[model samples]
Target: MAESGAPTQRESMADRIYQALKEDIFEFRLIPGDKFSESDIAQRLSASRTPVREALYRLEREGYVDVLFRSGWQIRQLDFKQIEELYDLRITLERAAMHKICRLDKPPPALRLLNDIWNPDAPSERAFGSTVRALDESFHCELVAAADNDEMTQVHQRITDRLRIVRRLDFTRPDRIDATYREHAEILQALIANNPGEAAEKMTAHIRTSQEAVKGISLERIREVSQQHRRREPGRP
Candidate 1:
């Protein structure tokens, strides 16, 4: 009960189910093109079919899932054309935000989080993983937010939300993780120096490299793991 005796609101089960499914997909547990029925999700999550169906419908609307027959759902595939478009859009928006950011007399408060992330002894220090990538996504979003433009931040968020499934895979290799950290540090240095031109260049390079890295890892892992799963089937010839 609240201090004023007003009841607190409860989160809907459908929302929970939607986030659970999204997390699984974003982490690659539910790989691209993997299919399952409504019953399958309901049983696995220990939730009723109604909420699962509701969640699937919401995910479908967001381009994360698609309806296959009457009750089947499949995780959407990440292809080169789609990724290229996403990265292109990302570059345009982010570069604009970086320009706006450099015009400011001071950096946004979000820089504190970025500083902590880069520091190993800091509380926010995360190695290469989905968590780190989620932070990376947030960093870009904060960049836009720091521009203080509402609409731009919203659009950047939508793109980043869907791109998470593929973007985080760039850190699969230790070398890639090291490269990301160094590049991020360099980008930060440029931003701190109030050099929009240099920051824009560095940001472009960092994002493009990550785009290429994600393409290789996500595509190859999907193909490699899918083949392994297929071969393990009892009837495989």
Candidate 2:
């Protein structure tokens, strides 16, 4: 019989494979419409087929890949219309959150933390690369959570997760990174003044700007970014 921790080991392997595959998709190493098999990933990652299957299914649930009967798996194509609709829905949720937040007796303490990050005193203190992308996501998610609505926060998080890969592309350019910091600061400032209308407007503009930026991503852009990624980490597959 297997040891008690065997399942844990399998789970760990599955998680590791999941992250690796997700990163590949994020970095455009695995472009949309690319197809491969469980054995392909299992061999490439030096993992077992069980863990590879586990990872692929998780990716499928997240809309990153699709399974094929008696074939294997394929990276899902970008659905621009669906992406646009999601951005629209995200704006709606966040706008509602701002209204709720403004009605609070006292502002949430998370605002202070967000201010520290987005309204940094020095540009030299600013984050770069994937760190900034993660911070950008947290900024929006935190705003929704601050509304004190559990259901809203949960739904917003799912949207954030679904949109993350495309959203990260926005931060790849220096201008977009600068704009994010500036725009996030504007939203925070409006919230501090307890102006829900202004806060919601700024949030909408910020998200729409990000939406437009990422929507411009094309296969050429993906290849360009993928090349840069490979150059940065030659050892990475």
| Residue pairs in candidate 1 whose N, alpha carbon or C atoms collide under 3 angstroms | none
lDDT of 2 by residue, 1-237 (tens): 134665444448888899899878877678788889999899999988999999999889878899999898999987888799889999999999999999998999988889998884678889989899888888889889999999999889878877876786777788888888899899999999999999999999998888888888776776677778788878545
TM-score of 1: 0.77
Can you give the lDDT of residue 40 in candidate 1? 86
Worst 10 residues of 2 by lDDT: 1-10
TM-score of each: 0.77, 0.83
C-alpha lDDT score of every prediction, in listed order? 0.77, 0.86
Give the Cα error of residue 235 in candidate 1, in Å. 22
Candidate with top lDDT is 2
User: Which segments of candidate 1 are over 4 A away from where they belong?
Assistant: 1-8, 69-71, 119-135, 218-220, 223-237
Candidate 2 clash total? 0
lDDT of 2: 0.86
